[model samples]
Structures are given as structure tokens and as C-alpha cells.
Target: MSAPDAGGESTRDREPVLRVRGLRKAYGERLVLDDVDLDVHAGDVVCLIGSSGSGKSTLLRCLDLLEPVDDGTIHLDGVEITDPAVDERAVRRRIGMVFQAYNLFPHLTVLENCTLAPRHAHGVRRREARDRALGLLERFGLAGHADQHPDRLSGGQQQRAAVVRALCTRPELLLLDEITAALDPELVGEVLDIVRDLAAGGTTMVLATHEMSFAREVATTVCFLEGGRILEQGPPARMFSDPTHERTRSFLKRVLAP
Candidate 1:
């Protein structure tokens, strides 16, 4: 699909890989997401940034169909995935999610962790799945650790393995929710480097991240979400340097201050 240029000309000819409109989610009486809307085109690395409790993770969960929304529409490749009757497992196969915690199974080896989803969910043969998993692990510098259990790998290595696991399914879209939040400060860069590589290779993604510098550096589009609403969104050059919302400026000031 055609995408808009930097000048914001119409790219309506190209449909977005993912489109969300009028999204709303709540827990009990508290609304965590309020009418959120977003569009992510193919090859776009869209980053959602905000203070804690601002619904960044909730939005990602909603998109992944992990959390049901009270109201809204989410379309993946033009299919209405939010519909109750839609095949959740099938949708998940086309969209991979990597969470803050590594979420790797304790009993599974790194290679097994990467191969399980494709092998079981999609009926891929074990050999074919293992071959693809190894290639991803090798490319991401995790080949040596493939036979190790999750407990044996460092936080950065495990997270990288999680990413490799997600990619093994060949998802059309990837959802990353604060993938570095649980890592050591020194270990964070290694995980971020994997994301940078994915962005460079044209992998479509929508990520919620607290790493301001990484968002600024790797995002094709930056969105500042506040109290579950997107207050401002634009190219990183503009969103980071010249946000129009007062709330966005205040939040950035607190986070970006030296």
C-alpha cells in the first residue's frame, strides 16, 4: 500500500497493515484507553511513548487481542480481528508479541522456545521450524546459546531469544511492549540493537517503549499517549523536537531532563 511522504500527502492508496479506530478499554470503572486511534503501514516502526499508567501497554495488549476492548475496531491487513467470532489463534500467528518479561518457558531450550509456536500452532514440520529458528538465532548472535535453558541466559540474551521466537512465525506485524524495561542498564542496549536491526530490515512494528533515545532514533512515527489518549503524533524529528501539546512537552521535560 502507498504511504504518505514526509509532507503528509495522502497515501490512501496504500492501506495500513494495522488500523485502529475509536478504541476504548476499561477495568471496572477506570478507563485505561479512551478512543485511541492509530494507523501503521508496512515497514513502519511506530513507537508509543508516555509516562507510567498512560495505557501504552494496554494499547498493545488490545491490538494483540490479549485484552478485549469495550469498544473500537482493529483491522489487521483489512480483516476485522476484534470481532468476537474471529479466530484468535490465527490472528496471533500473523502478529507476534514480545513482552517486558522474557516469558520463556523454564523447561524449553532456546531453540525449542523459538520453534514451538510455528511447529505446533501452524503445523510446520519440526526440522523446518528448527532450521528457521537457528538461522534467526545465528543472525541475532544467539546461536551459541540455542541449547541453553532460559535460566542460563542473561536478561538481554533471553529477550533477544524471545524476539527470535516471535519472528520464527514470520508474523506480518510485531508488537513490542517495553521489551527492555526488565533488563539491566548495560544489557538494555543489546536488546535495543535487535530492534534497530528489525527496523532497518523493514519489519513492520508498533511498540510501546520507555527508551526515549531509542524511540527518537529508530521510530518512523512517534506518538505521545497521555491518559490513554494520543495527544500528539508525527515524525520523530517533529514529535521529539517540536511537540505541539503542552502535556507532551511537560512529559518530555520530566523524562528527557539531564
Candidate 2:
């Protein structure tokens, strides 16, 4: 499939890796996501940027089927994943999610944590899973710490391991929800660097982030969400330098302020 152009419009006749339409989610009286629409083509690194409570994280969760939407449809690779008969576990196998918190098993070593999902959930062979886990760990500079528990690693190391764990599944698409939110200021760069590498390697990813500068640098497309809607979306260059929406401009002003 051909990649979308800089305007976020497809350049060829190909289905997006992930497609969302008229999505709505709410918590009783509070409407969190309202009629959201998104399309992520293969190899697209789409960034969702907004302040707290802007529904960025919720949208990612909904995409992963961790939270059921009150309305709308989600399609992965042209299949309707939100269908009632679709097996969520099967869908999740093709989509990897890394959360803000490391969420590593306290009792498991880093290698064990990385191999667990692939081996158990996806039914990959134990030895194969182990080999893949070790390879990813080595690639991410975590091989030396593979035998250690999560608590023993620094915040940056733990998050890197978390990313490695997600990659171990060999997912077709990755969803990251503020993966650097829990890290110390200095540690953010290390985790973001892994994402940069992944982007360069053509990984299809959708991420909710506050790291505006990193998003501008790494994202093929940047989306600004406000009040549970995407106010503006375009190439990172245009979205960062010249947003078309007033709300988006105001947001960029505050976040980009020195």
C-alpha cells in the first residue's frame, strides 16, 4: 500500500491499517469521546496531542478495545474489530499497547515479562518467544538487564523494557498512551528515542503524548483533540507551525511557550 501524502490523505488505493468512524464514549453523565474519526495508514506515526481530560488516552484505549465505545465502529486491516462476534483477544494480538505506567509484573524478570504475552496469549512457541524477546531486548539496550526484576531498573530502563515487551508480540500496529508520562524529565528522551527508531523502521503507531517537540519531529501526522474532538490534523510541519483552528492555535501557544 502506498503511504499517505503529507496532508494525511492517502496517495493510493489502499485501506488504512486502522480506521475509526463516528466513535463515541462516555462515563454516565460525562461524554469523553464524541463522534471521533481517524485513519492510520501502514507505517504512519500518528500523534494525538491534547491536554489532560481531552480524551486522547481514552481514544487509544478504545482503539485497543480495552474500553468499549458507546457508539461507532473500529476497523483493523479492513476487518470490523468492534463487531460483537469478533474475538477481542484475536484483535489484541495484532495491536500492541504500551501504557504510561510500566505495568511490568513485579515478580517476573524483564525477559519473562517480554515473553509472557507472546507465549501464552498468541500461542507462540516458548523457545521462539524467548529468542524474539532476547533479540528485542538486545536491540533496545536491555539485554544486560533481562534477568533483573522491574524494580531494579531505572524509570527509563523500565519504560524501555515495557516498549520492548509490546514489540515482542510482533504487532501489526502499536498504540502508546503517554508512555513517557511517568518518567523523570531526563528519562523522557530515552523512551522517545525508541519510538523514533520504531518510526524509522516503518512501525505503524498511534500515540497520545504531551512531548510536543518530539511529536513534531517524529510524527508523520499530528492531531489536536479538544473537548473530545479532533480540532485539527495535518502534517507535523503544518500542524506545529500553522494550525488552522483557533483552539489548536491556542493550545500550541500554551504548550510551545518557553
Candidate 3:
């Protein structure tokens, strides 16, 4: 990742853990993210809420450089990585992403899924990575299922393994794109509980979630994006209870309804 060639990254000598500005992406004529701006400091959980196709997931992908941005800059610890020419793997290594699907290897045991990334990305020894994997499994309440292949475990268990896999890489920032959204209603709670514990324990997270209640409980900051642009953003209390923008209020009402 190269340093930014322009201005407006507010991080000082300590460096902001993550910063994004004017992030834009599109496919032909369909604009996805229109100049999205966000900042995440150490140990903050920022929840992103939006309507379908609002580009929340795209924004997260762009941060990790999984998808090249059409315009804008993403800065991670003072490195300007928004340029399409930057080393994508270098950026991705610093930012871990947990996808909505439990993408664990069906044939691999829980322990294998957790240790794979660290061994491949960080070049960590298998013994060391396995040690860390075991610790994370225990932390996520899946230590007892270490030898079970993904198919043998419940969906909740598999998702937890995925989270542990991302954590094993020791990413400075974690992107959770609705990891529990695909689970059975009964199984969603277990995954959410693990994530709640992670946020409480000071993990830096950027979550795009439909779990508004869970977001309200765990997020330090909340953002509302609509049609590729952020409509509102503030502390959780303000964003939920006293949103200033009418569009934000309308969006929240529609999504947060019981």
C-alpha cells in the first residue's frame, strides 16, 4: 500500500486505524458508493445500516481493496491504498473480512479453518497458528468442536469458525458483512453473541448489518447510507433517537419496524 497523494486524513502521529473518503464505485451507469466517508479509530465498532443495494457491502469490500474503487481514497495507518494500482494483498492482509456465508471448507475440521489463513498469509508455523486457533475457538465457545468438519456442526458453529479464521490473521480492522443474516432465526443469536463479546473486548469492527437492535447495543457509532450516499451518522443514541435528516428518519422507520 502506498501513501496518499492528497489531503484530508485526520489521523495524527498515532494514525487513525482506518479512514475512507470520497469512495465511489459503479458498474456502467449504476452508481454504488457515492463519495462515502467513514473513519474508525482503535477499538471502535461502527455499524452501517442501509436499504438493499445501498452499497454498504461494496464500501467494506473497497476498504480491503477486494474491489477496486472508481474514485476516492482509503487510508489504513497512513498508507494510501485507494489507488487501483496498489498491492491488494497487502491491503487485505491488514483488513480481515467475514463474509455472510459460512465459507469454511466442508472437508476441513473447525481447527483447520481457523488456522489456514494465518499459515498462508502471515507465514505462521502450523503449531503456532493451531495454538492461536484453539484459543480463538475457546474464546468463541467452539473449542469442543475442533475436530468436526463444517457439515457436522450447526450453522452457528460454522459462522463462529469463520470469525475465528478472520481473527487468526491478526487484522488491524475486521469487516463483518452480515455474518448472521443468513442463519436460521434460532441460530442467529449464537453468532451475534460472539460478535457482541468481540466488540465488548475492544475489537475494531466495521459491520454492515440488518440487525439494528444488535447494532444499537454494540456499536459506538452508527451510519445510515441510502442510494450510495450516507444519509446520517453519529453516536448510536443520536442516530437512533434523534436523527436530524428526514430521509434518515424515513429509512430507519422502514427498516427498524417490528
What is the C-alpha lDDT profile of model 1 across 133-199, one tens digit per residue? Answer: 9999999999999999999999999999999999999999999999999999999999999999999
Model 1 clash tally, residue pairs:
2
Candidate 3 residue lDDT tens string, 35-71 = 7888788998999998879999898888878887899
Clashes of each: 2, 0, 0
Query: Model 1, residue 9: what's the lDDT?
Result: 40
In model 2, where do residues sit more than 4 Å from their true spots?
A: 1-10
| Residue 44 C-alpha lDDT in model 2 | 91
Cα RMSD of predicted structure 2: 3.2
What's the lDDT for candidate 2?
0.92
At residue 211, candidate 1 shows an lDDT of: 96
Ten-residue stretch with the least lDDT total in model 2: 1-10
lDDT of 2 by residue, 119-168 (tens): 99989999999999999999989999999999999999999999999999
Candidate 1 TM-score to native = 0.96
Worst 10 residues of 1 by lDDT: 1-10
The C-alpha local distance difference test score for the whole of candidate 1 amounts to: 0.92
